[model samples]
Each structure stands twice: as C-alpha cells, then as structure tokens.
Target: MTSSSFLLIGFIVYNLAFLMFVIAILGRKWAQDNPIEHTRKWGNYAIGATIIGLAGHAGFFFTRWYEAGHIPTSNMYEFMTFLGMMIIVAFIVVYFIYRAPVLGVFAVPIGIIIIGYASVFPKDVQPLIPALQSYWLKIHVTTAAFGEAFFAVGFAAGLMYLLRCVNFDSKEKGDRKEQRGVEVTIFSLVMIIAFVISIFGFNASGYHARFANDVLYTGKDGVEQTIKQNVDYVLPPIFKPFEGEQVEMKPFLGMTEAPFEAPSWMKGSNAGRKLNTVVWSIAGGLILYGLLRLIARKPLGAAISPLLKGIDLEDIDEISYRAIAIGYPIFTLGALIFAMIWAAEAWGRFWGWDPKEVWALIVFLYYAAYLHLRFSKGWQGKRSAWLAVIGFMVVMFTLVGVNLVIAGLHSYSGA
Candidate 1:
C-alpha cells in the first residue's frame, strides 16, 4: 500500500487501540468488583491491537524513508513520525522489563498526539538540503530522537508513580482509591500533555508566519530593495535621495546583497519554530496548573485498583534509573560527540554554542547531575524522582526546544 494509505490505516488502528485502553481503564472497577474471567483476556487483546498499530506505524515510516531515499526526519512531519515510533519501541521494552501495561495506557496516547502533531506539517517528500547531506545527520538525529522517546515514557511513568506515591500508602489503599485517583490522574496528565503540545503548535505556527513574511517581502532578489523602497516612502527625511537630479540608479545600488541566497533547506525551519512557540505556551499553562494543584494539595479521587495499587516505588525508581543508564551514554555519544563531528565537517567549526548544541549539553549536564546525586549523595525517593523529572525537562529541551528555538548548522534536520 502507499505510504499515505498505510499512515491512514495506522492512525485508525492506533485510535482504536487508544479507545480500548480507555475502556480497559474505565472498566477496571467493574472488573475488580465482578471478578470477571475476561479481564486479562481483554487486556491482552488491547495490547495486541496496540502492537499491531505500532507495526503499521513502523511500516508507514519505512515506506516514507524508502520513497525519500534517506531518513524521513528532515522536517516536522518526519520528526514526529520518528518520535512516535521511538515511543512505541520504548513502551514495548519497558513493558517487557517491568510487566506493566499500565504505562502503555499513558504512553500510547502520547504517541498518538505526536502523530497528530505531525499531521499539521505538509507530508510531501522533499529532497535533503546540503546541510543534511551527511552520515552523522542520520546517526546523530536518530539516536538523540530515540533517547528522547524513551525518556518520554520514563516521564509518563514517573509522573504516574509520583501521583500514586503521594496519594496512597500501600497497593491496597491505591486499589481502593483507584476510581477517583485514576480519573484524576488521567485528567491531569491529559491536561498537562495537551497544554505542552498546544504551545508547540502555537510556536510552530508563529514561526511559520514570520518565515512566510520574510520570504514574501524579500522576494527572489538578493537585494533588500523592498526594504529600501519602504524606507524611502516612510522615512523620506532620513532616506531622501542625494541632493541632486533624479538620475538613473544602478539596479543593485541599495542594500548589501547576501553572498548566497538562503538555502532551500531552510524552508521549514521557521514554521517549525512558530509551532514550538505555541506548544511551549500551552505547556506553560498546564505546568502552572499542575504546580498550583500541588501547592493547594488538591484531593483527586482515588483511581488505583487494589490489584494495581502501591507500585513498588523502589521498583519504579529502579526502572527509571535503568532507562537513563541505557539512554544516557547513547545520548551523549550521538548528541554530543557525533554531533560535534558533524558540526566541524559541515560548518568548519566543532562548537558554535548553537541552541541545539547548548540544549544537548544541558541534557548531558542534567543527567550528569542526576548520576552525581544518585551516587555521590546516595539520593533516592523524592530526590531521585525530582531528578528524573528534571532529566525529562532536559530531554524535552534537547528534543523539541533545541530544534525550534536554536538557529545553527543543523537547522536543515528540522531542529
């Protein structure tokens, strides 16, 4: 099937799986009260459906890459698709390690949201720009994106664990409190995710507007003659012609022409930037709400079921630590080492303090601090959770904010 067709099919399947997850969660109380034999059966079915949908999504991405003759991550649409795939892979790995499909209920929706965000960008197969014509582009971006995806799952689980921990003492209490707790947690999580996604959307849209305006007013000419004309018209006193007769002027007399035109590779960067602005704004609002709720000590209804109550916080913490342990070295190699090599090859400089690079360093440093806290001070529990939370923020900066806010040599890779 065509990639578009596959993508559509994948979207439908993913939505179906998402619905099943919601049903499974909503029916948790009924299953618990009724002692249904089919609970596990239905859960398995939902998981199978999710896996199938993920396969379809992977197929769609591979098809796109095959058609494009390179990685399909050179634009907003491609990056989002890749992110979705990475999230699923991470989810599967985590599920296998921890045997917790509950996390999937949180993670799959995030993948769906990423795919939905991708739909905002045009899906045309465009050629890679000169800046992206490097082997490291693939390695650096793919690995970093992979790390980000795993961290996203980590974030979801961490958030849930935090809520679960603060609200309940034991799994029994959590189970008893499941109904209200689950609903409240899900609601809060959704709100937070929505707010973050919306800000990105807004930022992307804003940048798109700015880029479009710049391109339109600049025209195809190398001269800023349009700007000069505006200056002449609006500020005649300052930009007045020399005190002489109206003589025919050279065509390129005004404005310092660029040695080269802006690369065609840059076409999507501004748009992505604008979208990120929107996403961040939305995220900011949700964060504010979450913080306020925390401060107010709002009592959300108990949502944990007896069976699902009281996660071994230590277990969850260990899972988070393992994820970082695996992800950190990979992230460092790809985002720092390989990225630097790519920069030197492409831009004649290894380090430019570009926003993307700065953010990568931030991610590395955050994790370094995490390790320091964990090992040096033997920190755990709340401190470790806080560190994990901070690590996710750094991951977000590396994944989304870096690409959107920073202008640099790697701009062509949609970052």
Candidate 2:
C-alpha cells in the first residue's frame, strides 16, 4: 500500500481500539463481568493494541524519514506524529506498572488529536534549511518531543484523577450521584475532544481554503508569481520559500529572497495541501467518537470500580511521581543544557532571549516548582495535582506555543 494509505489504516485501527476500550469502561464490563478480570483483560488488549499501533505508526514515520533523507520532524506535521508515538511508548511503560488501562483511554485520544494536528501541515518531505543541518538538530528536537509526550501523559493522569475525585466526593450520594458524575465526566471529555478536533480541522481547512481562493484568482499565469508573493508575505525569513538556485539572504535575520529550488528530495511528496483537510477530518471524527463514549458512561472511575481494586490511588499517584521523577532530570538536561549548547553553536551566543528559549526556561522553572512544592512543603493530592497540571501547561507552551506563536531560533524546526 502507499504510505498515505498505511497511515490512514493505522489511524482507523488505533482509534477503533480506543473506542472499544472506552465502551468497556463505560459499560462496566471488560473482557468479563468482574472488575479485576475485566480490567486485566481489557487493559492487556488496550496496551497490546497500542503496541501494535505504535509499531505501525513507527513504520509510517520511518518510511517518511527514508523518503525525506533527513529526520522526519522538520515541521509541525512530523513533530506531532513523533510526539504521538512517544506518548504511546510512555503509556505502555506506565501501564505495566499501574495496570490501569483507563489511563490509556484518556491518553491515546490526546495523542490522536496531536496526530490530527500534524495532519494539518502539508505532508511534503521538505528539506532542511542551512540552520537545521547540524547534529544538534536531532538531539535537541528528539529530547524536546520526548519531554512533551511525558508532560501530555502527566496531564491525562491529572485529569483522570480530578474526574474520579469529583465522583467520589459528590454530595448527592448513591446511584444518583454516580449517574450525575458519569454525565459530568462524559460531558467534559466530549467537550474537550470536540474542541481539539475542531482546532485541527479548522486549521487545515482554513489553510487549504485560503490557498484555493488564491489559486482561483491568480490562475496559471500568476502561479509562480503567486508562490513568490505568498512566500514573501506569509513566510518568516527563516522559512522563506525555496526555489532551485541559491539566493543571498541574511541567515540570522531570516531569508530575504526564497531559495532557488526546494531541496531535490521534496519534489514528488508535496501531495496537494487540501489532502490534509480530509485526513484530519476523519481522524478528528474518530477521536470525538471515542470521547463521546467516555462521556456517556458518566462516573467513569466509580462505574468501572465497585472498590478501587488492584490499583491504589496512592500507588497511581506514586506512579505519576515516579514518571515525573524520571522525566524531570532528562527534561532538564535537554531543555536547558543541550538547548543552550545548540544556541551557542548556531547563533554565536549561548542565550538570545528568543521566545522558544524563554518558554523552555519557563517549563524548567515550572517543573522545578512542582518538585519543590511536593518535597519541601509536603504537598500531595489535589495540591500536587494542580502543580502537575501547571507544569504540563508550561511544557505545552514550550512545545506548541514556541513553535506557533513565539518564533525563535528553534521555531523553524518541529514543535
């Protein structure tokens, strides 16, 4: 099959499995009727399916890399795909220890949403600019993406805990409270899922719609001129269009004239930009369906559990702590130490106060505060949960915000 065909198939299979898992939770039935047995069976199936999906996703990614001849993460599309895969890998590791498949139901959809976002970008295998031609590109980007994936998982777990806590404490009591909690949880999940999907769909559709309008008005004669005009107006100096021949531009200030040619490698893969809109719409729809199932069940945590079997809240909490513990050091090394080294190598200085750099520092500080509040002040439960949520926000800022809003030295690469 074609690479795009393979990706489409993978997207369908993964999301379908995710939906089944959600149904299992909401129906209060797993592979069997009993909670432990049900959880064990369903959890295994979910993780197993995720593992298979990850393999397929990785295959798609490597295929793109081979075609592109460089890393696959030179733009937002590739970056989001890579991040989604990383989140699945992290989920698998956490699942084994926590044995909570419920987390996967929440986490996987978010990964899917990110991949949907990636689909918004043209799937062309564009070439690396001169600035992105260094070894640090691989190290810096891979580490940053890994950190973002971990942060995303952390966010999922926090949300799940919050939902579960609300159900447990609701004053209504009994079946009524349980029913109400389930409704509320499902509503929240659906709303969040819809919003994310909409963003991805809107962004992809908007770009293509605008491009189509431009083409209609400009016609074939103005195609080249239109490309040049759009490149001049829309692209930042760092991301100026590539023509075939070399044109002199200040690398530090960004591109002036477009490059003479797009790298030879990018030629056939530029699939019409509108294709992304179709792909995102389908992926986003599946994600929304899975979330709707989660919503319909209401009181997700309580419905699935008569008693909080095998999994302890404290244990789940500790698992999160451990994940943060392991991730924190690696994140620090990559975001702070390695990023600075790369900046110095690229820009002739270690720090430039770029938006990306500032956000990276902000993420670092946020996590540091998380650790401090947890250990020094002896905070836990809701307090720590709130901190974890905030830390993930910082990570998101470093990931999407840095790439999209605050253009900087690292902005040219993947989010």
RMSD (CA, angstroms), candidate 1: 10.8
lDDT of 2 by residue, 48-95 (tens): 777778878888877887888888877877877888888777777777
- Evaluate model 1: give its TM-score: 0.70
Please give the lDDT score at residue 400 for candidate 2: 63
**Each model's lDDT:** 0.63, 0.62
Worst 10 residues of 2 by lDDT: 207-216
Candidate 2, residue 70: the lDDT equals 84
Question: Per-residue alpha-carbon lDDT of model 1 for 216-328, expressed as tens digits?
Answer: 24456665432221111110011122221222222222422111222334343253333434444455556665665576464342333333452567777776776677677
- Each model's backbone clash number: 42, 11
- Candidate 1 achieves a global lDDT of 0.63
